[model samples]
Target: METPSSDASAPSPWADAERIVLGRDARGGAVAVALDRGGEHGRRPLSSTELPVWVSAREAEGAATGRGIRWVWSSTAAWYSALLGAGVRVSRAHDLRLCHAVLRDAVPSASALREATAWDGAPAEAGPSAGALFELDDLSGNGAAGSRRPGRDGVAETVAELLRQDAAVAQAAHPGRMRLLLAAESAGALAAAEMRAAGVPWDAEHHDRILRDALGDRRAGGAPARMTRLAAEVREALGDPALSIDSPPRLLRALQRAGIRVESTSKWELGEIEHPAIAPLLEYKRLARLLTANGWAWLDEWVRDGRFRPVYIPGGVVTGRWASSGGGALQLPRQLRGALRADPGWRIVAADVAQLEPRVLAAMARDERMAEAARGRDLYEGIVAAGAVRTRAEAKIAVLGAMYGATTGDSGRLVPRLRRVFPDAMALVDAAARTGEEGGVVTTWLGRTSPPPDDAWRAAQARASRSGASPADETRALRIGRDRGRFTRNYVVQGTAAEWALAWLADVRLRLTRLAPVDSGEGAPRSGPAFARRAHLAFFLHDEVIVHAPAEHADAAAEALREAAEAAGRLLFGAFPIDFPLDLRISDSAAKD
Candidate 1:
């Protein structure tokens, strides 16, 4: 339902599906047919219907030059869109012939798909749905409610408390700690307040119940459960009532000393290996060293006004994203969230997006079966219902590969079944794969296109295609061309998915802006609170986001998350047969290890 635009002036097929059945074949390129409604001036499907056509710039120019329209430039789907939009009456009688004609011609030479000495046609294993080709607005935070005034020395109080708290000191040693934490806290508070201000209908208890239901299967025997146990141990070791967790080094050290071997593997790729304690350990330590030596001093100087406000980078990732500053907020070390603490009067409300990418994939593919599989329960289990090969792990592997481009082992074996069950989604990604391997430019749903292929590669393709080359030699050159094509093919979907994320973030920010502040009056500053206390988006890594808030508005923030998901769905795909849902979790800390 999230339709990509062929041209800015043209409406999307889904948006105009009622008017026509858009379609194409290789020969005629893009084509459309008007729908026939019962009664009235009905135009029945006719092979000889005089269809008036409008062509793109190239096609128009070709007509003027007396050269037949090439048809190779447009895709079958794109052509089909043209047909539907053109108002031709189409039916089953003409489906296959019309479709084949458009597709056969548009299909590149066999060289585009076959592997050869010069190159390969096969698409690279997909990456987690990522690529960028869309516009995204920045996250907003313009100070606390009713006034643009900065909060009184509240940042100082929080920082001071952080300084006194030994565990906080260890974690805050990282650069941008104060700023990032403050931003997160501010965002959370603002979300809570916004619900009160707007008087939106929300059920905090129901939200909590949903989260619990979602998490029920999470604790089943798995790496996740082990990680939880490790976390509890770290909290106990820290001996801080505040439950502050330092970044990775401290956590890793604690786990290592306790003799817990933390292992990780990239399931999508074969031979992907990680030592039990090395990879994540090194990652955590590297950040700690950088932040400790460089970021803290800068934070101290920047927050002189009692406010350590940081910019919120909305949709920063190849996908829709948001990032933060001052605290290296976006680069939060896993297991380090407990380091975030509020002042005496305030409590933390932390929330994150769950199963976001998969859900989006389901809706975008228009896989009602998959959507229903995800309905009312865990999406992983939904895959099980969809008939993924054995175990939840296998199901997860297949679903992820389908999104990211894993084409080996279980992932490869599983992808076929997923495609069989979800052809629309499969076809969408397949088109992307085809486009990239062919070295064509890839674009997102909103028209953001990838940079064209490198000149050297293009030159090689030309050289290989020359009339002088032997058939064998020519095959090699075409293969190279196809590899480049695969890259672009994957690029389109990944990039557009990111765009969708950004749009969703922007919508959430706009809605949250209308909310009012929560007044606990418990720590209610008599002279006004410190910091530029706004509901701030503090962290983002790909699809996930972290928002900080005051305890009073935690429920409201949760509700806003649901609203944001719905609004985003409407914005991208419109109300459809399928519903796009977001998995959400709210806690007092930012821990997802």
Candidate 2:
């Protein structure tokens, strides 16, 4: 197996595996499969002293070529026992191949990889192989091999199947590369959208150059006239040729002229410019801007291709959460999704979680009534139905407050009633509040901790903790009181929500991997560009995700979005106490929300 050009110099982690296998068919094509552990199987180090190696073979001789190979990682569940049956060093190789297959089979859209640290303070695992350590079967497929057909809901089945095949191809070409490209494109797209939304002219070459530069690939001479012409042509075909550029200062001026305000913030060295879109354009540009400015281009370079591939950031967020990179996988910008157009003959069937936070709260609290209320209609309405409040408006306020710790008028007034109705949910909030009041820091679901109080704040807290008869004590008390209050309110809802998100992502990844490929009817391009399997849960925000789907699948990629969210719920909770829902959308026109 040839190491990718990018990984040639890096240490291979799969070297020590007992056996390695690549699943290929008679025609030498990849067959995606759903896997299940069925029973306790085995575990091993993600990689060995030798570099992780994977061989892609055609059918017939390929499967047997590397006999005595101790491990094999394929998308198909049939291989589970077959590899064991191979008698060679046939253990399942833990890496992007397996993880991607798992993710693809598990869900259509989003996937997650949990983080576990090794003793040396370095990621115990290398990349995908290092992160992929769990073994599970395909839950969506028929229990046995050669037993899957499009379900009654042909739409979903078709989409799932398409994803499976695409994923298999992606894994073979390069696990998790297509997605990286998409993530990068997504950033560019997002930036383009934001500029357009703010009425700023955008330049494609300039933007591409910006991205190239962002990745430390700045060209000495300016972009070529041919490149500029090509970009303009692309813009014209898309019906927006004159709007591309590379100057941030010029963009700022345009935005100012357009009556939009730009505010900049940074994490590490990444700069974030936030501004409100004109009411009509809000949805369209939100996501585009987010990706462009927030490391999307760099993510593309890191992963491969220009897709928004998912990067597995285990514990990326404080609360045991995972974040994605390229595709705005985490922070999906709802407005611009309509621009997520697909390739020829393909269409996106997008969906998303409805009231994800509330439902998670219901499950965490084990509040049966709340769960029942949430069973059917809008969650806010369900809150009303459960007597959590008198009306829809009140329910909305209460629920939002509960999750966000909003202590303003309506949110503050409704908190008490919410507490009274859902004790379990309230308990989390109460605990968080107490912690906050004491100046404790809160974390997200994945255990990514927030920075604690700085020296001055800590000192103030210390002073406030004592009996404050003096003026300084009084000042400290007030400061601590305000700080603690804010922390406590956000702690519980955010943390628990993050947990639900991680579980959701993990579940979706697993289930979609179990499904088979779509028939694609007749004459559909069997393969082309697609996202690499199990790349990484890179970038994330509240409820949205941007997966770097493979270019092969790019033409028909929107299906992944829908599949991921559905898988997320099923894998996390199944059809149970509550439902975790989502709204999935797609777009191709970057600036059109």
Candidate 3:
């Protein structure tokens, strides 16, 4: 690998570059190329030991001189972690791995990158062995085919991919929107890494206390005390003292023997059945879930140094929403939120968007009536006020049914009224559903396309359309088609909502970095060296975000959160007269109450 130049008086190549691409040289060593508006200005290889210092210096210089630098790298997850570990943070980045996935699926026919399907593999995680950066399995069978292209792992390959992506975006049907989507998606990758590094403030004592209070005392090798008691109550009510409630099949048999006729033991079905054993059985199941999901074992494994550090996977879901690998981060139970306690002299600003999906639909469709209904208050209540439904409950059910393709029960029955009131909003989802039912793909507002129907679905449709197809075959095909329709119908709204959430997170992260750090004595040491003294994002759910900030900056953090929500709306919809109101709270704990 080429070494850093020895001339001390040489002008820095990165001094005026607007973008920099970082990758490994042929020798598996770090290399960076600076790019101005015209093209590449210079390229240099750096020792692994020198990489962090060089990046930090460039980042600091960029910040001081107002010369924003957007880092372009093969994978944010693989590269950003090392920089963050060394206390270096960048304002912007372009993750080629993530953008490749987006464009490959979104603009498959037009994207030159789609032809180079070696990039179609899963995202690279941190801590891989040296020289294994681009050694990913060929997942090109999904559509794109990998070429026998040499030098796929080098800096030159990365630069070439970046150029292809730029051309793809420029030639896309909605270039501006696609560009914004890629930027937001890349930002989410950075935020996910940063959030993992700076974990949520967890009060282990508080979490344990809550668990004990709810499930009774812990036991050595069995369920908690309250769970055991509830299990016993269920058996007593069923007149089967030795019954095993943990086994679904055995419990189903036991319930049937006790005259509780239910097909499944799910809580919803059990709640509908009025029996002496039902209440205790339900209680036992709830307690059992608590013990299994977030009990002592979970606490021991997930929490450390008063923080819960969960691994967040950006774009993990098909809808472009984030997913958690461990610690059930996305599935955090409301009961344990009290454990999300901030450090001393600090506060947590918790905010979540109100009816995010429905609001996104309204904005995407530009439905003026729906937007009016959503102005400054609860949307369901607004729908009720507009006479679309008799109650807020019906309005909510109808809106969800309209978006989710519900054709049965109360939700289905009330959807027609919503269609009449919000025709444009309903029409958008209806069209998406129709396209899905016909086995066609649908695109979100920002150009993230829904995955096409699989071969199984197409084969089923073909069987149903045969000359002598059976009625059963037809029925089965219709069911499968409608199921996919529901998925696609929701995909447009949910995917766009994910985009809005990313925009919100990216903006909030930038604004938080602008705030000055608190005194050293008041810093949250457990938040790691980079974020210990500053207001930084601590937790993010689909629509909710929690910021750990010093008490003195609580108001400012809350304001930034609200402003980011507004900015996200404008960024996605551009003055469409739609609002993304937030249910915000500033408190010492993240508990809803």
Off by over 4 Å in 1: 1-328, 467-486, 518-536, 577-586
Give the per-residue lDDT of model 1 (tens digit) for 1-593.
Answer: 32323342243322222223222222222233332223112111212123233323323343345542312111121122223333221111111111222122222232211111111111111110111111112112122212212111122121212122222223332323322222222232232222212211122333233333322223333323333444455456434333323544555445445455544212222124343433443433343344443233433543332223343333233322344434454554443344343333343444444565666666766767777777777777877877756678887888777766777898889989888877877787777767665666555554444556677677776777787877766676666666665555455566555555555554566554445655445542211232123343434445554554455655666677678767766766666444445556566444444
- Kindly list the per-residue Cα lDDT of model 3 for residues 1-593, writing each as its tens digit: 22377442245867788888887665577778888879878788777677777888778777767988899988888888877877778889998888998898888765467788777776666731242454323312122334434432557667777888988898777999999999999999989889888899999999999999999988898888888888989999988988999999999999999998999999999999998899988988988888889999999999999999998889999899999889999999999999999999899999999999999999999999999999999999999998999998898889989988989999878999999999999999999999999999998889998999998899999999999999999998998999999999999999999999999999999999989988757589888888988999999999999999999899999999999999999999998988999998999999987
The C-alpha stretches of model 2 lying farther than 4 A from their native spots are: 1-314, 321-335, 439-457, 466-472, 517-542, 545-576, 582-593
The better candidate by TM-score, 2 or 3, is: 3
Model 1 lDDT at residue 520 = 46
For 104-209, candidate 2 gives per-residue lDDT tens digits of 3223343211111111121212222222222213334233222332112111222233344344435433334333222222222222221111121112333454
Runs in model 3 deviating more than 4 A are 1-10, 127-131, 135-153
**Per-candidate alpha-carbon RMSD to the true structure:** 23.4, 16.8, 3.2
The candidate that wins on lDDT is 3
Q: Output the TM-score of candidate 1.
A: 0.48
Whole-model lDDT values for every prediction = 0.42, 0.41, 0.87
